[model samples]
Target: MEAPIKAPTPGAGGCGTVWWQSGTVYQIYPRSFQDSDGDGVGDLRGITARLDYLAWLGVDAVWISPFYRSPMADFGYDVADYCAVDPLFGTLADFDALISEAHRRKLKVILDFVPNHSSIAHPWFTESRASRMSAKRDWYIWRDPGPDGGPPNNWLSNFGGPAWTRDEATGQYYYHAFLPEQPDLNWRNPEVRAAMHDALRFWLARGVDGFRVDVIWHLIKDEGFRDNPQNPDFQPHQAGINRFHQVYSCDRPEVLDIIAGMRAVLRAYGERVLIGEIYLPIERLVTYYGPGLTGADLPFNFQLIQTPWRAEAVAALVAEYEAALPEGGWPNWVLGNHDQPRIAARVGEAQARIAAMLLLTLRGTPTLYYGDEIGLGHVPVPPERAQDPWGRNEPGHGRDPERTPMQWEDAPNAGFTAGTPWLPLTGDANRRNVDELRDDSRSILTLYRRLLSLRRDHSALSVGAWRGLALPSDLAAEVFAYERIADGETLRILLNFSNQGWSVPLDEGGPWQILLSTHSGRAGDRVERQLRLEPDEGVILGPPGR
Candidate 1:
């Protein structure tokens, strides 16, 4: 068993600079962002080439997805070398140059750090599997098969398979919470904890502003190796395929200690932030911040990403999240990512724009997935062309649809590649590229830019407390209304999620100023008395001031 580390004091000041508040983060999926080497895959250099575009979008930081050295088992989530950039992406110098260029553009860079597991090809795992007496043997979870010569327990992989992989050479089974190629790291070991800590320091020393920790909750597993209880209501599509609940398998109390250790390392660097990717329910997710213990600065609020597009559902989710946050803890919002279907596809193309407005107007730091600004829909990837392991294993339903190459121009491959892209580019890429949408005032891209600029210009939208407003009965379930109050200023935001126009009821006693609107036809006379909203429209009403 790994030695236990003492937890750090909560709210300890001077742990670098925490700047996540009031910040807009743009997420970049490196493999599909841009390809500078003409290798048909996006790389660090490709991202560097687009720094000006990101800066122009008015985002405070760019959260680049995993680009670490890996065997690509689960993309870059399975880290083979924590300190180096994968050759496919570029070299260390390439990453350094990307960082320098981003900083020059006033864009902070936050890299994705996968601390939960390492690639089977990783040296640590290689040594651990060599022999039972190896020094690093305890760095991974291993056990002898049961009497029936199967895995020790009934653990299941998130990708639809047994969680244990048996090694013929060693006659032992290794634990892999995801894929067999990605083995769960034994955080129970002190050496493993120290090594992971050193990895963070390595990147911070290179001038990264922060880290987006991948699967932070899965870092430490149950030490007893007990079988997870069968989940009676388990659905095939649900992430939890195991017959049992994951109480002991994941989110262990021991994980908090590892987070504290990570925080200690980041504390050494000034102003560095850690945002964790946790897929737990709100109550459990909030615990990552520690009632009084120091852990990740932002645990990543994914409620919006997973919830349906209904108004009441979204509103209740927002309220619940805002209420569940620990005292002094900040909240974050992620609407789309590489793992899930595009919000445009989930909701409609029109509704996607409204979603963007809601995300920007909501309280907390907003993270925009790549291509979300243009309301990009999921591009279908045929079985033969699919590259995602999950997609390969489970045809037609994996994340390949969302991981297609980006649409940058009306060119052949959406300007993502000069050659055929590794994955098929969407047919709508011609219309959704940056060149076509950036200048169009009616385009979703422009709407996002304007909203972000407006949010930056107004403090009420950034750090204000959100209050939900009752919507008129005529409005569809797609419409959502809310008010943000800060410093005695109230900003009313109305979003119509439907494709049909609806007249919005106004408070007769108050005069509202139209600060912004997404509708191309709604720019005429301001709302002097009552407000009328067009189909797929969004309007921001600011209190009389300026």
Candidate 2:
């Protein structure tokens, strides 16, 4: 069997767990995290200014979204320079300072690595587009027009329309799984692979703990470039790109080799993480861990985000995902991200609390999106203020709603920036800001902070064995229950997925104390045997001795 990644030295009464498994990750969208210079946009230095808040929140690592040099086409996802910081976000010195402060506060730094595509402005793409004879012509995927002067075969961009855009000057069409300005790289080329791997080395040399690779599955494509078949189940409400089944375009087998290559670079720097942004079937997602376990350290399990919020549905998903995890592969969970609707908005305010409990207690590394702790819902973006190209092209499908500025306090602009904020703040700043939640024990922010603290202080919640329990045959159908145990400690987690109250008999142990409850004012209570669950509430219990 392949050896598992080495574990950090264990503490008293704690299991030996890898840093990624034992710690929580907080994702910061750099454009909205904080604005130190009052540029109305967040920067690396602004992130430095906010390190203390993360430290206070008790996350072990911070995964900041792209802050690399880009033209803001897809925000920072379109990189113009692999090794340079964008002037809009600040200089290299600023990033270094952020890293220093994060580390000093015992937090690791994970950068967003967008190797799938680089901005057309990138020197590599610039040279490739310069002339057909340019040495870097093969650096990106370029195809000649077909019989009707159309794109080669058929593939669709995630944003909208055709996957290929014609370069009139060069008489060739370049492929882009996203925006036309973001040209897909030819990972089939060894030079391209080496250079992309070098980008990892560049940041590794600068103390970046790891990378959250964007579109890792889209890095390679089928060699035949066949036209994808139409999806028979495609619905009109879904994104237009879903019209095609993506059979010939993405999630290719060769992509595993590329991810493995990136993994090798990370291995050179001990104990670092490699998080891939893969939205695929559960079985397919785990394959990124590569044969012999040498691929991405975390393939990013997002089932919870995509699965229906019903109890049976979520329970089955959790069980299937756990069963499908490859040996020694670390699991990670993401509730809401910059790409999706906020959890509170997606599952309703009541269920979001239960979702937070599930995310933390589940056996995996939990990724907390910025502002989720404060129950930030989606904020609308007016037509004129809409900056996302996705929303611009697709009309109603913009991500701006979920990418609003962090609401730190009730002051003028929610303390995110001095100037008019980039994206509108979500909810009344006075009612939803972190400053307000700090003193409200019943707030979502309090639940998140308490959950993080619980996970950090107890191995049972963080790096423990998970076992889904079957509910009583006569009990209500809207509850999910599980147990996590480690180092002689155990926690029984129960959640009522519906509005109605529920009840379950205690396990065959003794003297259990209410370690935590989603409903405020119930923790610290003792449960003799029969445990009553509050409406839409979740609870975590531990033996009195534990």
Candidate 3:
């Protein structure tokens, strides 16, 4: 097992630097992480039970997916109560205990705050739908039918079909950017903004360190409810939501103001973070940092998840993203999340090691998906066993594969649950589990532990200045190189993106020390001239000796 990591001394990197700036965050899908109840689903206590694992893994924080009261329509995304814990997960006291324990380990707790919409069963939504003139009627986005007696405009649900669902009782339609069960809140209403901000304060007062605001870009809609322009580049294979450019529906200029307001609420509690879940292009994404950096502390950078896994592609993406950041804005990176396919499945298993090195060494906060540390690939969910409403509504785009139960051991159900897992475990769970890999010197888990430890120990890797180095002429397309320097310390990361070995020439005159290698075969090796890299290998080099 990896040795446990002690909490960093206060202001270890710098006195004023935020914990998130130098610390790593791990995203845990609660239902898939662990199951203490033996009820086939993961819960708060289960996550608490695994706090040691996270602390040992050396992550600085835990960003738990939604565990609030819900009707399970979109799992916990369709929240019925922002303050109450879902019985499926645990109670409010259980969440308190989780926060207490996580803090004890010096791990920050970031809750998934779904502010874009609430479950249709939410008390506010229920009362809003009760009557057209009800006091809460304006809390949600309700619109009259179009002139042709059809639903409002050409808006489309992210899942499928119309974004508007007719309320037969009130003879009006309610808007839902995602599912009909998830009714979008009308942020145009001042009361709605106040209520949502209050929910944030509720958590902050309870010792929650921060929040990952869900669908933050979708908080506001165009006042005129105008039609989105048709996408000229629409492909038949793409989801229907992509048929139109989401111009009027989402990423409105007004959403930034809403995010700023939320940030202000978080600021009331010292040093708390507000991370916006925005998926816009890098140019637009930086705007969420606000015109004066008053918006989200970190607008999640998902370019790594979407970018092509090639040396040149990733290198260019990094350069573009770094160039686009607003002044004083902090950047964050994500490799895999609950929504996307696993990194192991995206790039082959060998390359995942390379990806891990890149993520940890990059000059930003890295949010790691739970199972990626052990190289968990996607698990195929059978048709009948599928649970994602999005997948059920639209065939073939299911996230169940990526959200499967974490493989902890080689037991039945992979030790995720005493009962049958809510979703299936990866096929190689027996061989590719935490217990099996923990002791393997060269295993991916060991690599992750070492990289995280190195990041913690070196200011250069934690809060350093990053610069992409020009690759040698012959190795330009196959290698991605970068140097990080901070506080008189410098480190170089070299990644081989190709499947063929290359003898990378070192012209900078470096007697380089291999600090860490993906293959676990090169640490402590001294390179006098050309450094030889095996296929799909990556290595971190210490500063040249005197």
Counted clashes in each candidate structure: 7, 0, 0
Best by lDDT: 3
Listed in order, each prediction's TM-score against the native is 0.94, 0.96, 0.97
- Indicate whether candidate 1 or candidate 3 has the larger lDDT: 3
**lDDT tens digits by residue: candidate 3, 299-373:** 999999889899989988987887777666667899999998999999989999999999999888899999999
Per-residue C-alpha lDDT of model 2 across residues 1-546, encoded as one tens digit per residue:
111222212342354457887889999999999998887999888889888989988899999999889998999999999999999999999988888888999999999999999998999999999999999999999999989999998799999999999999999999999999999999999999999889999999999999999989999999989899999999888888999999789998889899989998999998889999999999899898899788888998889999998898888888788777777777789998999999998988898899999999988889999989998886878888999999888887889999999999889789999998988886588678989898888998889889998988787888777777777744536988888877777688889899988878885654688989999998889897779998899999998844
lDDT of 3 at 58: 93
Off by over 4 Å in 1: 1-18, 236-242, 472-478, 521-525
Q: Order candidates by TM-score, high to low.
A: 3, 2, 1
Task: Provide the clash count, candidate 3.
Answer: 0
Runs of candidate 2 exceeding 4 Å displacement: 1-16, 473-476
Give per-residue lDDT, candidate 2, residue 286: 88
- Which stretches in model 3 have alpha-carbon errors above 4 Å? 1-13, 544-546
Over 211-326, each residue of candidate 1 has an lDDT whose tens digit, in order, gives 99888998888878888888888777655454679887798998888888888788888778888899889999999997574988889888888787777688778778877777
Q: How would you order the candidates by lDDT, starting with the best?
A: 3, 2, 1
| Residue pairs with backbone atoms closer than 3 Å in model 2 (clashes) | none
